[model samples]
Target chain A: MLSPAYLAVAAALLLALGPALPAFAGRPIIAGKPAPSEAAATARWLTAQNTWGFLSTISSDLSGAPFGNVVSYSDGVPGESHGIPYFYLTTLDPTARDALEDQRTSFTLSEFPLGTCGKIDPENPTCAKLTLTGKLKLVDLQSSEADLAKSALFTKHPEMKDWPKNHHFQILKLEIENIFLIDWFGGPKPISPTEYLEYGKNQALLKLS
Target chain B: MLSPAYLAVAAALLLALGPALPAFAGRPIIAGKPAPSEAAATARWLTAQNTWGFLSTISSDLSGAPFGNVVSYSDGVPGESHGIPYFYLTTLDPTARDALEDQRTSFTLSEFPLGTCGKIDPENPTCAKLTLTGKLKLVDLQSSEADLAKSALFTKHPEMKDWPKNHHFQILKLEIENIFLIDWFGGPKPISPTEYLEYGKNQALLKLS
Candidate 1:
């Protein structure tokens, strides 16, 4: 084993090499992830950790084809996740336009980008993926829930605050009805929407304390 | 200006650091991405570089809700791309099953994960995102095109070959109808599927020479 003096020198070297480290080294403050075995917790962790995912809606433009668009979202502010993803979208984009015409949608996230699945193929079941299917509903700007959503979104995606005001960006959220989580080799984990949303309420409280 | 000797020393230092360098520094051989100004080229680049994306289909299980699932795909082997995304999907997954019932689908990809969009919020228009909407069609196993797809899929996603044979994985290709690409601040760049598929044909031929 190395002596204390040697360890101290190595630590100093690492500190001096700041900004040269890999980007993944400085992960954003994630609202803790759950063990793979905890289906509800795992599903919630995906919602909290991922900053962007594909949001799908039945497209009126494409004669009712399912259109998936890359979108940024937040479940809550860091370490205080509520397991419901909120998006800032504009009808100028097809996804929002489609949602207005057809509320049915799904938001899909993968753990591959989280940098935890080293050397594993992203398609591999062990890497984990989540699909939350539900209605994509607009949040009324005047509602208290919209206030919470705005705070959650702005904190995670600071750039959203400065998007062109004329674009009429509105807050939209998925009223999750079904949760499909694949965290292991077997089939999808059975996670009801309610179980997923409530999985870490106490833990989040503990973290805040 | 630094002396030649000084520059050589700096280069040596970087080489010695090896794994300490940022992971993006070691990007896989990408079919060179076109300038952001080349809308069709940029859209094709997104498809050629990304290994996985969100495939959205009309979900039969969820009462025709648009379902987005994370899936692995390939447009071609490294340095050679045809701009058609091929997926090895199993009906055991909802996405494939959904596609069988309703072929209308869209595959979405983002450049943020490719590590090219440094410090850009994923939702930012400059970061680049693509959505290919089309019919997801199965390639018959007996067709010569299936052989080409298999080669492309195996080269990029080797683990696919090892997946359980009993899982009934089949090759599926998106017959792209529309292309939505956002690479700059303006808006989605309008690109026809034909323009996207043919954008780099001449460049690809020149490279082969």
Candidate 2:
């Protein structure tokens, strides 16, 4: 019942798929099906990779409201299972000092071109490349077994030998509360919170796996 | 003659090298006896991967300077050398549309965290992050060839299918002039007009790879 022209067009469309898909086209394979509580899986994936990430500290003074600096980061292994992307960092850096003075800060990581290449509207909450907001808490160093864990930290980055060592850098850890994770492609499902945590034993969410 | 205590201490220190260094440090490994050109090498390496960096476009009309947003990007490819990063973007978003009209636009691409992140201080060139004056251009979707090169743009983003499609994204690109890359930890080399085109061309600049 279809016209001859329609038949010809269908044939052409079929032929184009093979050459077009792989050559001048691109695709990323993401199995987006996550369990009900597997919210932090994406954060886990991001932390698992050796991606460049930053540790931001809120400046204490009102003059320095929300300033952040780039710093190397590591994932919180056990805490991640709880859905909070906790990072290991020191309070010695100015940014960290500022954050300690005021714990509010932005910790960001991005999977970029893939995110921006598409239509991104800043007004649209979903449009940001990488956005996270939370309070940065300085955790204890020697409170736990610092000796054994210290070796692990050094093993990962041997350059610390040259740095002027400090218990702040050597002791305190960082934890991100009320976190936000934005993955451009294959990111986790978006969840908009009506209100930030009112403060509790664990004020964080989206733990790294 | 040196004291016996000094000699013993030096011997013990030499033996401790194996356990002294921390594992997750940023100091680059200097394979040779001399510290290589750490600044230039670090700058080059940092500029290399920081392509998706944020381009902070500022604008003001009747009211005053509006808040800013970071634009995701990709610069020069690995094989065919180019100093300026190549960014593919579109005008569908209001920010880009508004940015197109503003001439005083500038960008700051935060390189992967330097233990101390460099921030932008436009007036002070000495500051690690400074105004790298550049211009923005819109794409002409008619050029199918260029569009083909960035075709994979959407394959990775299936959520994008929900948004309307426009061809202009295929044509637009950015050309940055008088730009300098900065690194706080790495010894930063001076950026010259010629070096922008000459040195960075061969390096695999963007994080795309």
Candidate 3:
């Protein structure tokens, strides 16, 4: 292993040249961001890496207008992602209440936060962005899925496990019906829910890695 | 002013102790993030500082379900923010098309990307998140407002000026009607559109600064 002094020097060099480099510190891409062409893998990877996304729902209070809210979520615990995003929320929040009144929802994530986009503008087509549209349904608290979801969520957002009991936080997951991803210039890549969900299983056998 | 060597050392020290620091490089808060109690200022600051946010609108193709898309927006040319977000969108994208069919939309921004949230969970109310619900109206290319918007957008997003002409990108502005800002624990701050828009003008004399 390299000495601590050497590691510090290397890290200092990275900081000095961070802006000039394509990828740098605390960025998800350094671990491994899939190529833009791998639509399903890229989409899955985004879900797995991002701890939070913007959740949108049809507003009941605003007379059916769409409302977008920043929310924390987990696809799975660390590396064992299953593609479906689980959220811990309370009805005191409009997003959760809106979902109860209207299940239709969409969750959006961006690669910009991951710091992999380099100098590219967040709006640039080359900077990956994903939107998953579906029904936001509450998982039965007593079910096995809820147990798995809680573990997935707590691992990514540790504070979530200790959220105030008075708020009555519940587990909700996006039953993804459609996926909209833009990682390249062509346009939004068409990724079916099944294709995205199955990417991890096929990755071991396929050359996507 | 510090010498180059001293500045490099400072930056290296920051990187070395980054995890322990509440705020670091490239974060918007380093300049000025308003106190959480100043709801209107906090909301406007978020709109002005953030280059992009999640835009949600009623989907035309999805039978009225909500759809959220990652978009880049400019509230103004750098520090001259007018408190209204302007977006350069193409009809080819679903967000623009959806807005055409239904103007009701909400744009969400989070402090997480600004790096000011530090170790706070994004879902925590202290991290500061804003949702602006409004009507997404296409600004007529012939209007003088469109010219100002173009200047504002191009100033921040230089790439937008060079976007493909064939795409027929248009300027869209959000006519914010409701503002939901969660800057600290309690619940969403009650700030009307007028209160938010008026904050900058009143900040000159108010102690909020």
After the best TM-score superposition of candidate 2, give how far the Cα of residue B207 lies from its true spot, in angstroms.
17
iRMSD per prediction, in order: 9.7, 9.5, 6.9
Q: Poorest 10 consecutive residues of model 1 chain A by lDDT? A: A22-31
Query: Which of 1 and 3 is ahead in DockQ?
Result: 3
**Given candidate 2, what's the lDDT at residue A187?**
31
> What is the docking quality class of candidate 3?
acceptable
Q: Which lDDT tens digits does candidate 2 get at residues A1-209?
A: 44445534544564467543222122222333122223344444444342334444433432332233444444333332222333334443455566657655555554332233244332222333334445566545645534434443344334433443442364333343333444322333444332211212254433222
Q: How far is candidate 1 from the true structure (C-alpha RMSD, Å)?
A: 12.5
Error of 2 at A62 (Å): 17
Model 3: per-residue Cα lDDT over A101-146, one tens digit each: 8899999999889887877788877678999999999999999999
Best-first order by lDDT: 3, 1, 2
Model 2 has an lDDT value of: 0.39
Write model 2 residue lDDT over B1-209, tens digit each, in one string: 43445544644554466435332222232221112233333344444444344443432321222213344343334423243443444454333654577533334445323322233221111223422435556545566635543442333232333332432442334455544344333322456535554654555434223
For candidate 1, lDDT tens digit of each residue in B11-52? 456446665542112122223445556788678778888899
Write model 3 residue lDDT over B136-162, tens digit each, in one string.
999999999999999989998887776
RMSD of 2: 11.9
Candidate 1 vs. true structure, TM-score = 0.82
lDDT per residue as tens, model 1, A1-209: 44445534654564466545321121221234555556776777677778999899888888988888889999888878888899999888889999888888899999999887666678777678999999899999999999999999999888677676777899999999988899765589898887887776666433321
Better of 1 and 2 by lDDT: 1
Which residue pairs show backbone clashes in model 1? none
Which candidate has the highest TM-score of all? 3
